[model samples]
Target: MPLPWDSQHFEISVGQIISPALTNSELENILSYAKEQGYHLIYWATCPDRMIPLPLLQSFSGSLVDRKVTYQRKLSTEFTFGEIKNPSHSFEVIEFPRSQANQQLKTLALIAGAHSRFHDDPCISKEKFAGMYHIWINRSTLHEIADVVFIVKNSANMEDCLGMVTGSVKNGIGKVGLMGVQKKVQGQGIGSLLMKTLHEWLISNGIHTSEVVTQKNNIRACKFYERFGYKLESLQHYYHFWVQL
Candidate 1:
């Protein structure tokens, strides 16, 4: 399952593929084809349960870059919206509108400082990484993939963004697409408040299950989600393969 349209670079989610194994020839052919099709940078994900032989992977000229854990939770019961008071009494959580793309892009740029794994990969520069997220948000707006986006704003000044949360639903399952709190508000409870609100929104929309993924090194994010009842589901190994054009 390669998600080429998700970003400027192509990403093959091997963990999602049920293939027993990718033979040397198959891997070569796939890489060759992707290169022929003008895919300069390619990456893939695999888990312990569906391990790719190290020898087979070593044959490629690419590099292993990141590891992530996927977390999931079932929405069996209704959730009561928890206390999400803004200490300044100036912030409010509101739906993100496509009209505010440019503004949100600025906010996201700041938020992404805490996020360094995928963006910090050798193959991705700061500009390219930001492009990846911009493309994702564009797809979300145009394709309804991530149809739900919420932002915490200062009521006194709507332009003052504190954090953001985004989600998408498909086939009765929901996914937290992205969540970030600005540097200034990281220590505050904004992240937790956003998660609780998103959970409540998912339940109200009849979603039966929801999931999210974060880098293994993101201890704060992992612990935060777990506190909200999201259980560890899978740990995935990530690799990036570069092709010369």
Candidate 2:
């Protein structure tokens, strides 16, 4: 499938191989189609249990870029906030207007994607990654991509944002979009607080199940979700195939 948004944003013809299974002949046909369409890159994802042969992908110059992990859990009314170690540094979680906190939210968005797959991909420029996150946060604030955004702010200084989380509900299921804590405030239960706020918001909206995806290489993130009671739902291998002239 052609990714028009990505193609236009990155100034490259980009597409994704959505089919999980591919015969050798079908692979050749897909490559031919990409060339005919002047595609510069094609993305493909597969589960570990049903992956395409390494030699087959090697023939097409497909490079493994990320191991994506999906986590999920059912939201319940029986939820409690984790204890905050520093009562002196009190914080409050609130839903803030985008107009009031766009810049801070953008900063948090950059932090969220700092070590993401896009940042790790050598083919994707750093500038492009930054641009992508900026666009994402902007749209998310507009509710074009996400339903709501919550921020954890210092109680003493409302202007001080320690972390933020974005969530959306669809068909009784909630999904986390972007979440991050300021580097200076990380590991102080701020991330857990943001998640608590997110869970409350999701429950209020009648969403009982929530899901999130992260790079497997991000050990901290994986552990964080696991600690929060989210179980591994699926794991996928992502590849980027750059079409050669």
Candidate 3:
């Protein structure tokens, strides 16, 4: 079902539709109706284990956006803490202020790299990506939606933002929402320090398990989380359909 606030079109299928030919026609009709209603983009996701009708999917001129895998790390008393290295790259992680939403948005907009589907999609423009990033960072300000948000900054110059992480607690499980490092300092261990600090903070808040999701094609992100003891839990795929109206 499409959310009332969603502007894009969505269609979902479940429990085998038996007749492939009929299913394909129905899907085509749905797309036509969506186009008539001024929707240029559509999203469709299916059960990971179920057999997807390739002919039906290929019938549309859309692209595969992501193949994501979920990973979880369990905190234990035996866990060890490592030193956040790189003295030349001294930085601090501080709780983000709601008053500084614009500043945060600007920093995130400059992020040249992302592993997520939307950012990696060639069809999506940088302007659209920045708009999406703004919506994401501001979600934490909503009541009961996020527990904490921390931003990484240069210790020598506190106002200079480097990276940020958002987390939430649900049913006693801590989940990483969004985290990214600036492209200029990406490989200098900033991302590692950010996750390490976030893990410690989660543990102190009584969270025994932490989880994060990243596209399987994002090798760097997957490797980074695995180094922090996060194990793969599950995988899912999603398709993105775009048509010019």
Candidate 4:
């Protein structure tokens, strides 16, 4: 028997249908159907949040699922803001207000990057991915905006000590996702510079607060977000499992 929100808790196998344009009613219908079939946990698409199918929750039938706080961070009503005034690195790229078309290209690129081979399906399929990529690229110019950043390179080459950080803006708040540097890139202030740039962009957009959800064991990431002015808001638990058509 599948858990209440099975599709969200585990990786989807072949034959499992995924949707990018599913409506609230449609998702509820599928979730309801999955519940009746003994499946638990489901994938959800949050569009303004980048349509990334982020496994952000463990949903279930009202009969079986309980919303529990596993990990969370709250935004202040009067959150302090910061801005990036100087740029010392040539690779620091930032985009603004998160254009739908431009973000589509970014998600596609991240899907194809060195780190996305395994989790690509959970995000989007290759065909749909390629299609979205072309659409966004055609509509998005290389205009340097003030709110987005790019750490892109020709390849994923890195020294043993360099670290990297990733983030996203949700409903105007900037949430830092993950950050680590390779040994070579560590201690050179790359991570801080990136952080500064992101915060600057946030302030410029009148976005002062930030939020993100991380697993319980990801202590490093949690601490990093705090250091960047994010306070713990709540804990969240997400379930995973597969569902038969």
Candidate 1's C-alpha lDDT? 0.67
What would the TM-scores of all predictions be? 0.76, 0.92, 0.78, 0.42
Tens-place lDDT digits, model 1, residues 11-126: 42211223425665776677677667666556666664655556555555566566778899887665543566557665678877765365564556436434555575665666
Which residue pairs show collisions in model 1?
none
lDDT of 3 by residue, 31-82 (tens): 6665565555666654466344675556555666878789998987577646
lDDT score, candidate 4: 0.42
Q: Which pairs of residues have clashing backbones in candidate 2?
A: none
Per-residue lDDT of 1-245 in model 4, one digit per residue for the tens? Answer: 23332233233322222654555466556666765755433443222222223331224322211122223344444544344223343344333233444433444333323232222344345655455434433333332222243342212332111233355566766765433344434444555555666666566677766555544344554565576665556543222223332
Best by TM-score: 2
lDDT ranking, high to low: 2, 3, 1, 4
> Against the unseen true structure, what C-alpha lDDT does each candidate score?
0.67, 0.85, 0.68, 0.42
The full ranking of all candidates by TM-score, starting with the best, is 2, 3, 1, 4
Model 3 ranges off by over 4 Å: 8-39, 47-55, 109-113, 141-144, 243-245
Q: How many clashes (backbone N, Cα, C below 3 Å) per candidate?
A: 0, 0, 0, 43
Best-fitting candidate, scored by lDDT = 2
